[model samples]
Target: MLEVKLHDIGEGMTEGEIIHYLVKPGERVIADQPLVEVQTDKMVAELPSPGAGTIKEIIISTGTTVAVGTTLLYIEGEGSLEPVSEGKASETPKEEVPVLLKEKNEFVSSFNRVLATPYTRKIARDHHINIEDVTPSDPSGRVTEEDVYRFMKGEQLAENEAVSTIVEPEVLAKPISPDEIPFRGIRKQIAKKMTKSLFTIPHVTHFDEVNMTNLLKLREELKKEGVHVSVPAFFMKALVFALKDFPVFNAELDEENDRILLKKEYHLGIAVDTKEGLIVPVIHHADKKSIQQIHDEMKCLNEKARDGKLAAADIQNSTFTVSNVGPLGSTGATPIINYPETALIAFHKTKKVPIVTENDEIIIGHVMTLSMSFDHRVADGATAVAFTNRFASLIEQPNKLMLEMI
Candidate 1:
């Protein structure tokens, strides 16, 4: 028997919740076959089998959270075996065998064994509803406190027809306590990173407005050729060009050595908003790829991010970052800097506004506002302003990007 230990799932992840087990004891499995689905803070990934063998036992049950390097199961096979440490298998009652055998039931129903946070379970208990019956809306398939409240509201509405209700003035005047949500998973990770960035780095923001008339026309032209381009793609290309001229923006401060490390390669980080939280996926070598190539790659990365399929490497090694709030229809925002990176650029919504041309004539044109935040320690106000101006020039006159495309 060989021990199948929970290996490192990368991205500095130390622990994961066993979402479900695909195979059972005595089941013959092949190499690379998915043995279990483990949900980390970033994503839900399938842990594959180590070798082709019959599963001897499952040491960890579903919904169990374990750290890395813990024994998950054991596989029996023909080999010169070495002594391996094993974990005790979870004990289940014989009468519960029928429930466990049911393939549709992914979770093993037991005390404090539901795939939910303590807050969610508390809300469920207060409402007198089972957490298992609450439909989970999160991508990880874990029940949330909101789900419990929603279930309670639905039940209350259904029973309202059978009962009469009266509102009291004292009850209405009483202040209600706000529900506190515990920070965990991706939300917790975001909070930690944001706090570190804000407290550690002295951020200076530079705001500018760009004439996006040319960019809009170019996007239309590209759409006609069966190539769909987005605002973030164009901004990413502009950032790469600006970084080439101002390499200081594409650098990180090494306080230990008291030096700045300037990166030669342009690995642009694109911030993607998902149902879980905000995740940034890096587009390696942004300088080498054309605008169309960037668009295609960004599309694939966004899909993976929303589906929680992004690997650790997909998010690593970013020299510069771009956060586009245009999709949310915001005019502008002062975005927080992604830690370790020297600078971050944000693109706002493109709108039709009246512009004064070179002849001082008022004409309607497409306009987009951009906000860039840089670490003051790495870059000064003048350098950050110059970089933003260069980026705006590229966006206003998109022919420069078109030349690169050709």
Candidate 2:
């Protein structure tokens, strides 16, 4: 019998809820075929079968939260399981690690088990250190937290590392509540990522409003031609056109060496707000799509996202992102740059604002703001401003909608 354990479906993800099982007991499954659907904090993901076999048992049920090493199913196979060697993509169950470590020493339990966590083990392996060599000082013979930490700091570990001999000073023994509450669900994930990005990359936001009356009129014209379009669809079309003239805004930041990577194609990420959280699905090759095509795509995506049918692939890989808060009557607000991407444009609610024509005649016209936030490391203030200006010009002139056709 082959036990199928939960694997890390994504980077930085440690747990997932078993949302569904595609197969039942005694079902014959093919290799690489989907076995179950797991919902992480981000999206619902499908887990594929490891090999062709008949499922013998289903261990975890729907709505059950399982960690990386938790076994979810067992399969009866014809061949015996072979031990995976180094350089193999296959991963052994967590149970195998302790069994292997026990062979080296019966006291493998003594070292702080904290270091035995998958992430810590991966970190140790990346650092080219053997976990067995590190000794745990905890009373239960389990590796104490300090042993792993000290090893990471390059402190020499004896043949048998000693657990701490002395207790902590009284000053360190106080129980204190944290000032900031821990975040849960999507908000927490967003908080952690945004904080990391904000600190790692220097960000600057540029705000500018556009006269959207022309675009509004254009949308009406399209509706008359049997095409329904949202303000976001129009914005997506305009942004795609604007990218042709301002490719730098569609670039990414290389933080490790401090450089910018300018991509040739534009894959626009449309931010969709769901009851659970926010998801941005990319419209690949958006620059090549027509206004109506963008409209249809947005409509399809919006419907799928709102209905919770969004697949994992739909929310991944975006060259740039667009956040339209204008529908909520927001005039203007700064948005955080979606990391890796150098910029994201925040759109405000479009409304009729009084404007004086070149003839000096004052009239109420459609006006809106496009707030652009960018990584200063990848783009300076001037580039961001110039890009917004191009987008603004396109929004003010309804005839530019024709530009998408050409």
| Per-residue lDDT of candidate 1, residues 340-398 (tens digit) | 89999888888899999999999999998888999998889999888888888888898
**What are the runs in model 2 whose C-alpha is more than 4 Å off?**
3-37, 51-74, 78-185
lDDT of 2 at 80: 26
Q: What's model 2's lDDT at 182? A: 24
Go through the candidates in order and give each one's C-alpha lDDT. Answer: 0.78, 0.71
Weakest lDDT window of 10 consecutive positions for candidate 2: 106-115
Local accuracy of candidate 2 as per-residue lDDT tens digits, 1-406: 6678888765346787776676788776666767786766566667887765567889998767778889999876423255332224245466665654554353221212232332233335445566677776766554433566788776445432443543557536778767873244444456666787788778789988788777778778878998787777777877877777888888877667777787888889888887556767778888778767888898888877765567666676688999988778887777887776888898887777789999999999977777888887777898878888887777788676666557
- TM-score between candidate 1 and the true structure: 0.69
- Candidate No. with top TM-score: 1
Error of 2 at 107 (Å): 44
Q: Which pairs of residues have clashing backbones in candidate 1?
A: none
